[model samples]
Target: MCEEQTVSLVDVLEEDEELEEEASAVLGGSDSDSCSYPQGYVKRQALYACNTCTPQGGEAAGVCLACSYKCHEGHDLYELYTKRNFRCDCGNRKFSGLQCKLYHEKDAVNSQNKYNHNFFGVYCTCRRPYPDPDDQVEDEMIQCVVCEDWLHGRHLGRVVPDCVELQEMICESCMNKNPFLWTYAAHLAGPEVLVEERRDESCANVPKKAEVDDVIEPSCKRSREEVEPSCRLKVLQASQQKRDQSGAVFWPSAWRSKLCSCITCQAQLSAAGLSFLLDELDTVLAYENKGKSSEQVHQGHDPLMSALDNLNRVQQLEIIHGYNDMKTELKDFLQTFAAEGKVVTSEDIRHFFEQQSRKRRRVDAGPFYCS
Candidate 1:
């Protein structure tokens, strides 16, 4: 019984080694053959295998996907699955989807999960078949994402891979036919002409007429040299309207008309309009009645307040002028601040004068009052 058991164990070991050898032979073990294609590939392709291990009779049957030589005739290509020698006839080192069942767990819910299976596709890494993937898989074909159609990878360059959870089984040809679906940003039509037309029309009312001849010539002029006064008014009115519509037009000459259309520009113009109102507030706040017993602060409000309250064109101009004056004053204030290392506020100026008055009072003993 002991002798018989030993012989059976030896036979089992021999069978295992034979199986391992067959597995290696199924994968293209030869380093000389390989294939490559740049565009990318997809297919029910023959996996990478070792050319050295492939049998002579197998060469004529189902050709290597990498080299197009049928090395396995009667047997299915996927039967040669194994741990160390997992590869295809094309010399692809990675397992194809057909053989994926043996080594990879199929994730029905999420195929993209790399942990599950390499459902994304196979990559060629065959050392024996140096450029085998190129030689095995046809260059013209690709697995379409939309439809599972095998198409020339070159022709489907226009198609963008959809960002879908499931692989796009449909080919590029089917995608082109669908009205709802189209190509990516690169394939979209040219500049939107309608949008451009709308923008042009927005500033269409702003009249910027060409300059007419300034000098009046005599001696039977061939044509009348007078321009319409109304036309000039229209131009001025347009300029003002454009300014009002867009805000201050200060930019590249081409952009000036469009500048007023921006919301920020409108807000800026509105803020500038408040300058005249602030000026009126200042006049009211100023101290009046310098030297007389009868002198009193003006109880009645300034008439300019009423004008400022109403947002008329004249008020806007006043506001603009005031804004310019304030800008100049601000520049002077900034210079003073830089030199002093502190901002000189209105309260600071008033307090300074108050201190001067206190010094004068301390020095004078007699009743010294200035009217």
Candidate 2:
């Protein structure tokens, strides 16, 4: 029965399953077969922009996963990954020539959705595409917790700290716009390493908890009305305080929890347009977890693994070699279609393997002469 070749076969399949899981993590839990327009403004979902229709410098637009396939199958797309509080805009006024196939009804615009240069296929301070083919150096794009825009590490204007996945980042632009965040960064930002030996010395201006409470509540327990004005006055004074932030701030894991929850701070948060920062569900990690949980494990995916048990070793090796060869060749064969932004149809895939079979036959028939 199948043995050594069978081991190779199992190894190949295991690798494929891992790749499928990783892809699922990116796609989240969005229904790929259904248009998301009917769902109204989604809190977060994988979205894409079609370069064939919404070109660079044009009105930026986003479509749901189903529309990416049904309406813009052959178009080059900018994978926007995921955006929050967005509704599907497929076949909206921005697109000149495409119509929604999955759900034909759509409004003329999705005005609530946000846009950045990334919708046009550029990223980072360098303004390069995600996989900039012309660049030699390799880099990873890191998303800012504030703007939610992706940036390269080198252009962050600060040295990226280690264990970045364990940290939340506020890009310099966000920090500068709200200088008050620097006060929190100095006093409350965590994971410990980012805090200096002299944190207390540097953040001396920030009021300690008991001091703040004493200022708000006075000598003893007080009614809500009696304490409210004092709390507001103390925090407004605290809000005016700023800490020196020389660069982008890296916050410790679950740093959002460190934010003050007192009534006055809540009012301050609402006033500064930062209430979303308090919502743990708004993080990218939460969104990806939703997608991962939704991924249905297809049953019978490993049925071939069971069937391999009955095959002779010779047949097993033949199957293994064929699978390995086809995987490599098929990938090489598909690159052209991807580069051309063309959708590969079932017929095209069949034709490619047929040509591969003919080429194999020609090679098997060759005669090695004096050379």
The number of the candidate with the highest TM-score is: 2
Give the runs in model 2 whose Cα sits over 4 Å from its true position: 1-18, 190-243, 261-272, 296-371
Lowest lDDT sum, 10 consecutive residues, model 1, at: 243-252
Q: Evaluate model 2: give its lDDT.
A: 0.72
Candidate 1 backbone overlaps, count: 49
Error of 1 at 91 (Å): 28
**Model 2, residue pairs in steric clash:** 28-291
Q: What is the TM-score of each candidate against the true structure?
A: 0.15, 0.64
Model 1 lDDT tens row, 140-242:
3333322222344323332222221111223333434532122210111111112113332222222222211111112114546654332222233233221
Judged by whole-model lDDT over C-alpha atoms, candidate 1 comes out at 0.30
Predictions in order: lDDT: 0.30, 0.72
Instruction: Give the lDDT of residue 303 in candidate 2.
Output: 69
